[model samples]
Target: MPEHCAAFSCSNRRTIASRARGITFHKFPKDKDVRKKWEVALRREGFHASDTSVLCSHHFNQGDFDRTGQIVRLRDGVIPSVFSFPVHLQRLEKGRATSSSRRAEESLSVASQDSQEMATSSPQPQPNDVNISTLNVIS
Candidate 1:
């Protein structure tokens, strides 16, 4: 089986075209700390990198690689940091946003309440709306 990029939305495969495009594939680092960082960058909950798992160059900055040698290699201690994760798949920063699980539930509940209010509520009369009958007309 062809090795595919392990990133969530990346579809890059281990093919000649990919190589030709200068997109080098990299294996997860052997260092436990570095490998864990790579896994976290993937934003894949409960994801663990297997022996064959790889991430494409597209998920890393150019500086992360060492291209001075004949073969492209990742610089020591570097982690994959570049990715185009969708909004929903993005992680919320601690203390900056609500937790993902609670955010979805809260948003849905708020939306439902807003819809209900819209359906039953009439537009309030503006201050400019006058009851002509209540005004004494100067004949």
Candidate 2:
């Protein structure tokens, strides 16, 4: 298929041959220290692999690199962690704002309904007895 996957040694050969040809490969380290460094870097970059037993144990033992410089089986199928404090706060603020707005709208609606009812129930002013000349002068 593609030039990159055409190489027989490429692990993604089958995937590349398929209709969905995109394959992302991660490089693991052979050196233990280097592997640890890579795992630490991933952790720093908000990759929460600590909760998973497989990833944590692998990274703890062999770092991220195996004997062949390939990424270890650890941390496979783990969803990327999101560590955005600002985004979380923004979501909370938006929720609060929406709730407050809804409450305010409900209060306004109730007040309007009350006013409508009052208007409907109250006695209307008489056209003949009212002082139109005084009302015009005040306006």
Best by TM-score: 1
Per-residue error (Å), model 2, residue 73: 65
Candidate 1, lDDT over the whole model: 0.89
Over 16-118, each residue of candidate 1 has an lDDT whose tens digit, in order, gives 9989998899999888888999998899989999988999999988888889989999889888888889999887786425689688888989999999999
Alpha-carbon lDDT of model 2: 0.42
Writing each residue's lDDT as its tens digit, candidate 2 over 8-37 gives 122233343432443333334445565455
Give model 2 RMSD, 1 decimal. 17.7
Every model's TM-score: 0.64, 0.24
- Reference-based lDDT, residue 60, model 1: 86
Q: TM-score of predicted model 2?
A: 0.24
Worst 10 residues of 2 by lDDT: 51-60
Residue 81 of model 2: what lDDT?
Answer: 28
